[model samples]
Every structure is written in C-alpha cells, then in structure tokens.
Target: MSDHTPSPDQAPGAPHPRETVQLIGQDAAQQAFLTAYNSDRLHHGWLLTGPRGVGKATLAWRIAQFLLATPPSDDTGLFGAPPPPGTLDIDLDHPITHRIHAGAEPGLAAITRSVNDQGRLRNEIVVDDIRKLGRFFGLSSADGGRRVVIVDSADEMNVSAANALLKMLEEPPARTTLLLISHQPSRLLPTIRSRCRTLRLAPLDPDDMQAALAQTNTEVFGQTDHLAALAAGSVGNAVRLINLGGLELYAELIAILGTLPRLDRQRALKLAETAAQRGAAEKFDLLLSLIDIALSRLALTGATGAAPMPEAALNEAETLTRLSGSPRQARHWAEVAALITARTRHGQAVNLDPASLVLDTVFKIQEIAGHSR
Candidate 1:
C-alpha cells in the first residue's frame, strides 16, 4: 500500500474513501478464478484465508470489481453465484469501480471493523454487519445480474456475528457472491469454513514486496531490503514502518542491543522510564520490535563471530525482549494494549499510570527471562 494516501480530489467520493492498497502474490488466486471460468465452475461463497495484513480484502474488492461491471449473459451457465473468474476483466477506472471503492455498490456489500460511538474502533465484526449481508445479497442484482457481499475478515466475527453469517450461507441468495476473508481460519468455526470455498493466500515474496515499495514511492527508507524484511511480506507493514518512523525506532533498538552490556542500571531504568511515558500500545509495539531486533542481532553475532559484546548484558536484554514478545505474556500485553487504545479512543483518556504499567511489564519480562535461563 502506498504511504501516500490519495487526496480527496484524487480519491473518489472525496474524504474518507477507502484507499487502494497494493495487493501482492494473488496470481494463483486470480488463476483459480480463471480456471473456474474456463471450466464453467463457480462457487457461491469463498473464504479467503491468510495471515494478517495479507491482501484478503484487496482480493475481495478485485472480485467485486469484476462482478459489478461484467455482463450478465457472461455467466458460464454455472448454477452458483460466481460464474467464471476469467469472465470479468476488472477495470479500476470503471464507473462502478468508484461505487465499489466507495463502498456504495448496491450489488456489493462489505463487512469490516467500524468505529464505535464511543470513538473506540470495534475489533470484532458485529452481528449487525453480518445480518446486512443477507439483505445485500438477497435482493436481485441491481441490473438483474450477480450480487456480492464481502466480509473483510470473518475471523473477527464473534459467535453471534458468525451465526448471523451462517444463516445466510445455509440459504444463499441466487446470483449472489459471498467473499469472506479470514486471517486466522483455524479460529473460525468449522461449520463456517465448510460452507465456503477456501482460498489460501501466502505471504508476499521478497520480489513482490520490492515492487510494491517502488510503487509507493517511499524514498524515506533507502534500505528497501531492510524494510521489506522488516515488513515480513506485508506491504501494509512496510508502509506503516516508513510512515510511523519505525525505521528510526528499530535502529535505536539495535543501538540499545549493541550497548546493553555496558549500560549501567541508571541508564536502563531511564530508558524504561521513557518507554513508560509512551503509554501501553506504543510500549508494546516497541517491546516487540526490540525483541525482533535483538533476535536479528543475535543471528548476526552468531554468523560474524564478532568479539563477544557484554554476554551477560546482551543476555539480560534478550530475556526482557523475549518475555515481552512471548505468547503467554502477549495475552497480558494485549489486555493493556487494548485498554490503552480504548482509552485513547475515548477522548485521549489517559487514566492508567504509564510508569506502573511499564514497571509491571518489565518485571514480567524479568520473570520470563529467569525461567528461560
């Protein structure tokens, strides 16, 4: 995705329009549809599954782009919603493109996390969002063609939300397409999984990441390789790293790792204090990034056989970093992160004591480290 979000003028429907994020490694997915189109086999519903930040939503939109504009007679005589994948050449400049991108296409509907009245964003796709799918797809296509509804990610739907969606799946509307995206498909109910054709999208390749970064025109990070590797194959993460000054933070953490051994207790505590002031979410991301940097450095150190930096000090830093990133610890970290974000959403409500939270997190890190050793 480009760090340069389209301006109101460039963006259709002006302000608050959905930005077009670059999608990577969808050739197989695209080909799957092509094969189906050629074979006259189209499923009514599809579940696109992959890790977070992958292009599930983007792919869903692409599919929508095809359905909204393609001629109705183009259906490959298929019984279900989707006719043939190759049947639609999705043009980004199409008039219907604007409608789909603006999320106003009558033939297409999208379910995603929406901001709540309290200003905090809803993490879960609610039941109401799913219920709308039926209404969106149940009616005949606006032009008497195919109708589509996309759940940006089915994984976020709670039990109620999932059930609401299940009803629509059981008795699908004719000439309707249901595209459900899932980051953690394993977490979704098997019944839901069984109802939809599953398409798994893998992480982007290094080449894909490079191409996307080039398109974004992000010159700030001259180290494309570093950024790509840091992104872990998600263009979203790559853009985030560039726009959020993540590179500088990672570099700082690298420096901290290099100097941890020689650092005195006062210095460590001072750094901790600064982190404390960052509040929970920032601190949590920092902690994860710090650990990631430490692990990378460890690999580098092991490979280069450089003069051993303070082993004990590096050990201590690694311990703290690991605990901060551990799954067991991540549970607690998430609670704090969620609370802090919720508070921030509520008028930047800063109720929790930053110092206390940091102290507790660090102490937990120490405990994890001790156990590991």
Candidate 2:
C-alpha cells in the first residue's frame, strides 16, 4: 500500500503555498486586486486578512508573481496600448515563476518564522527576519524591476518585528509591494493596518473546498461531507481532520454521547484509553477539540430552537435534541463547555494523565445530562 501520510508541516505532500501555482475559492479578492492594478491605483502594501487556510497566502504569492513578471506601462508612445493584466496569472515557464518557486528571485523576499541555531523553528518572526527585508529593499532590483515582499503571516511577528515593518510601510520604496498575510488582522499594529489596503478572503464553499482538496490529492473518498462540516469551510483544517481520523473519532464520540445520562462506560473507557496511549498526543488533542465542537452544536441547537443538522456525525441532531432540548439545558451545557475547556487546557498544561482528562470531561457531560433530567 502507498504511504498516504502528510508531512509534519504540510498536508498531503502538497507544495508550500508559495510554490502553489493555482489560487482557489477567492475570486472576489482576486478581482478587487486586478481592478486596482488595472486602474493604476495599486497600493504599495496589501493586507490579506481572513480565516486560516483560506487561500490568503496563495493569493499573496499570485500577486507577487504578477507584479514581478509584468512591467509597468509607459504611456510615452502613440502606439503605447499595453494590455492591462486581467488575472493574477503568469505562465509556469515565466522566468519570475521559475525564480520564485526556487526561492532565487532577487526581486522577491518572503519573511516567515526561521529556525534557531538549535534547528527548531522559533515561535515568532523576529526583528532580524524583518531586517532581511531592509537588505532586500536596499538593493536595487535587477533591471529596475518591481520588488515584492511577502510576510506569510503578520500575526506571527513579534512586536519589534511589527514596528520594523511599520517603518517600511511608512516610507515604502518606489515600485515595491508588501503583501502581509494575517489570519487575525486585529492583532496587528493599527498603524501598519492603516497603511495597507485590505483584501479579505472568505472561507471556501463546499464545491471550492472539494476542488482544493482534490488539487492537493487529498483522498477523503466517502467522508467528504463529514470532513467539510468538521472543518467549517477551511481546507487546512479539513486536511488535519482527515489525517487524524477525525471523522471516525467524531462518530464514536457522538455514539457515546447518544448513551448519555445512562452513560456507556465500556465504550467511553475504550476511547479514553485509546487517547491516553503513548504517542497518541495528536489524537488526544483532536478528541478534546471534537468534544468542544459537539458541545457548541448542542448548545446552539437548544438555544435557537432550529432543526439540528447532523453535519459531523450520524444521529448527532437527535442526540443534541435529547441532551439539550431547552434554553436552560443549553445554558447548562454552555457552562459545562466553558468549565471543561478551561480544565482541559489546564490538564494539558500540567501534563496530567490524558485518560483521566478524557474521562473527566465525559463524566461532566453525563452529570449535566443527569441534572437536566
């Protein structure tokens, strides 16, 4: 059998977003950028803001490729009718495409978290990484072409790094474009955000999500619907869920919940044991996450009085209705969710036994169900 394992860093062995040539599920953002570029009102800096894994980085790279490959128009001659770029695409054989993919493009620089001397990735993008942008900009572009710098995620930058970037945005170089990808733009410096035009990318619809997964050769087979619902429209999250066997685990969790108030001790113990096994840290984390998701859905279903959709697991809707059928029960579950979330975080922080943590959370849910009865 072929190994279907994703790399530790990426999903389905797909190339880095920078090396990805296609952009999916972000047509409006792309059009807004093309409109600006075609109107000759392109800003020096662009802040690409959106949820994680929704094509922000891909759009940044696409824009970088377009800017570096397309030269500025000169209205100097009578026949100077240079076609405006309608799309952010250049041929794969384009020199800029080859150079950017190889990370050898002098006109482009990408700033991201760097490895420390100990060979581990640092937690944040430091000022020194931003300083590299200074050196990159200091050198004139070969042939005086446009320069582009991409910060894969501005949210990961340290305060010092952000301030350093702010200085550059304050006095941007001629013909330079800075693309900042931020999952949470609210966390960035207000001054930095103010200097850039914002392009917000929305989460993908189901069709787009499927297209994205297929493009990466992610083999979901029969679980596409469950994966889509569990991922909440984020392709990156879907990939992680698929790699972790989240669908089956969530189904198991819902089945256990279905026996709530009565408490299925044997099945619950099996799940807790599985999560507590050595080297199952990822599974443990995913269990806690899925529990939180299920609880949230229950609370929402109760409070809204809307028909529940069994998106994540079979019989989820009926189970939620049975467990949290009234506003009071919904409030009770919400409080339980908050308490369990805090406890779970604390348990992980203190390195508590994973089995005990899982059992504790499940018992709490059972207790709440009992009280509701």
Candidate 3:
C-alpha cells in the first residue's frame, strides 16, 4: 500500500489520532484503564467503546504508548519495586514516542481498512488483514518486549476477519496488548465483545471540546456553543463542520425556514444553486443533513415545548416555533421530513440534478408549512 493513501480512520482535514499526543475530556475512561494497570489485572484485549470522534482511537494510542514506554513492575530487589502508574502521559520526546510518531515503532501495529490487490481501499477488513498480524506477532515476539496492536474499528471487520481476531483473543501472545476501538459495540460479535474488557468514553463538554480543538490548532472564536451543539461534542464532526462552512449553511437553512408558509422563492433558489455547484457534493450532503436536523428539532420543540438548546443556527428557534408550534404541526413536519428525505436520497442515488433535488425538498417543506398555517 502506498504510504500516502488516505487513511480510512482519520477524518479529512483532521490530524491522525496517533498524532494527537493527549486525549482530552476522557479522564474517567483513562482512570478505568489506570485502575486496571495499577492492580496488575490489565486484560490482554481492551475494547474502547464510544461515539465516533470521541477519542476512542486516541485513548488506544495513549494506552499503547504507556504500555511500551513504562517498564513492567520493575524489580530492583534491594531498591524495591517502583510505584504504580497514575497516568497514561509519557514524555512527548521519549524515544518510544518519537518512534510512534514516525510510524517506526517496531512493537506497534495499526490496522485499518487495507488496500486490496487493485490498490483500492477495501470497505471491510478482510481475513488477510487479520492474518498479517500473525507475521507481526512472529517478528515482534523475538524482542520479548511489550507489543501493542490497535484495530481502529473492529466493527468494520468482516466475519472471517473477526473470527481470525477472535482466535488471537482466545489465546493472546505473551506481553501483547490488543486495543479495539469501536464506535458501536452492538455491531460486533457477542463473543468478541465478551472476550475484552470495555473502556467507555463519553462526549466532551463545550470547554473540553474547545481545549481539544485548540490542541489541534483549530480555533473557534465566538461560536463554541453553536459548534458544540451542532457537533454533539465530536471533535471530528466539529472539524468537518468548520472545514465546510457548515455553520453558515445551517444558518441560511434556518433563514429559509423563517420565510415559511409564504416561502421566498428567490432565497430558496440561491441556496439550491449553491448546493449544485461543482465540488459541492459534500456540502450538498451536509445540507440534506441540516434539513433533517431542522425537522427533528421542530418535532422535538412541539413535543417538549422548547427548541433544543444552544441553537445550531441563528433564528432556528424562532423558525421552529413558528413552523411547529403544536404537536399536530410537528407531526406533519416529521412525516414530511421522512418522505422528502427518502425521495431526495433516491433522486440523488439516480443522479438527479443537485439543484432540482434540493429545490424540490424546499418546496415540499413549504407545502407542509402552508398547511400548518
């Protein structure tokens, strides 16, 4: 595989998880792992489970670094054993750290979706990908040092590949630690889930999100709350939003909704044309997602008597209140959202013109709004 092939594990325009030296807003998960290590009861297999972009991969990298760098229960005899590790942080300039950054760490292996014979990255981790570890285990074992293997997402492993991994978990090699990062543990085999101890990570709060973003040099000036609300505390999602001007797009969407019942044709046309522009496919997909978000918020506002807080876009609450002021209206919008989403997605699948598809979606929402009024 070419070294420059974009990794499936890393988000676009975001630093690779291994490049993130520190994992922020996950102290509880870190503590749990530390508790396992300090007690000398560290499991051979670890499953780090959490939402996407919540630092599961980063935590795995952290654990790998800690295991390889820290000497195992040093036995000095007369000097007595050293104290247990209280944190996962190691010196950033340590040789092990340096090697890991360079992807030259002999004791570490990171497995993601691998390129096939055609040089195309496969969507699933094939059995061959898992089998390659057999070779890795063979070579790394000669050193007799701790070895770490990180599977970015065990969920993406095919059945055969998973079975291969299952065998390793069944009889793990000496001084080897397997870290599995799973965004959705339910998709994994029950047997696989049962074999490993789970360390669960949670979403970051706004402050933590800001700090995490800053660590990557992603500075958001006055829109932290808005971005936090929109991203749901996922740094990966936050970066995508920032890279694609999602905030401005979402705000424009809300403004269009504000003109509902008597929808502004000119404004709607402008938005649709923007989505149709060349190289705007990602933006178009995000626009559809924002529409779904608006509809869901409308439904939620009517049901709960309030809009979801921190407002993902300007004037969103006002538009939601005006358009879905009652449960009946909210239900109407929900049904409209479902039908329109399915139809538009199908149109997109069939290569429908982007401008018309987006415009059609807006008109349908306008029809629903007119009825509600």
In candidate 2, which residue pairs get closer than 3 Å at backbone N, Cα or C atoms, i.e. clash? none
Model 1, position 53, has a per-residue lDDT of 52
Worst lDDT 10-window in candidate 3? 74-83
Error of 3 at 135 (Å): 0.8
Please provide, for model 3 over 165-256, each residue's C-alpha lDDT reduced to its tens digit, 9 standing for 90 to 100: 99999999999999999999999999999999999999999989988888877767677778988888899888888988888888888999
Alpha carbon lDDT at 279, candidate 2 = 83
**Best-fitting candidate, measured by TM-score?**
3
TM-scores of the models, in the order given: 0.70, 0.91, 0.91
Residues 105-200 of candidate 2: C-alpha lDDT, one tens digit per residue? 899888888777766677799999999876787775545778999997899999999999999999998889999999899999999999999999
Worst 10 residues of 2 by lDDT: 1-10
Candidate that scores best on lDDT: 3
Better of 2 and 3 by lDDT: 3
Candidate 1 per-residue lDDT over residues 1-373, each given as its tens digit: 1333322112112112134444557778867865764665667889988765556666777777776677554544557454434534566678888777665777777677655676556778788777766566555445577788878668888999999888888888777778888878898888889999887787788788776556566554366655655667766566666765566555544444344334334544554565555434555454455444444434343334331233323233453353344444444444444444343334224544544444443344344334432
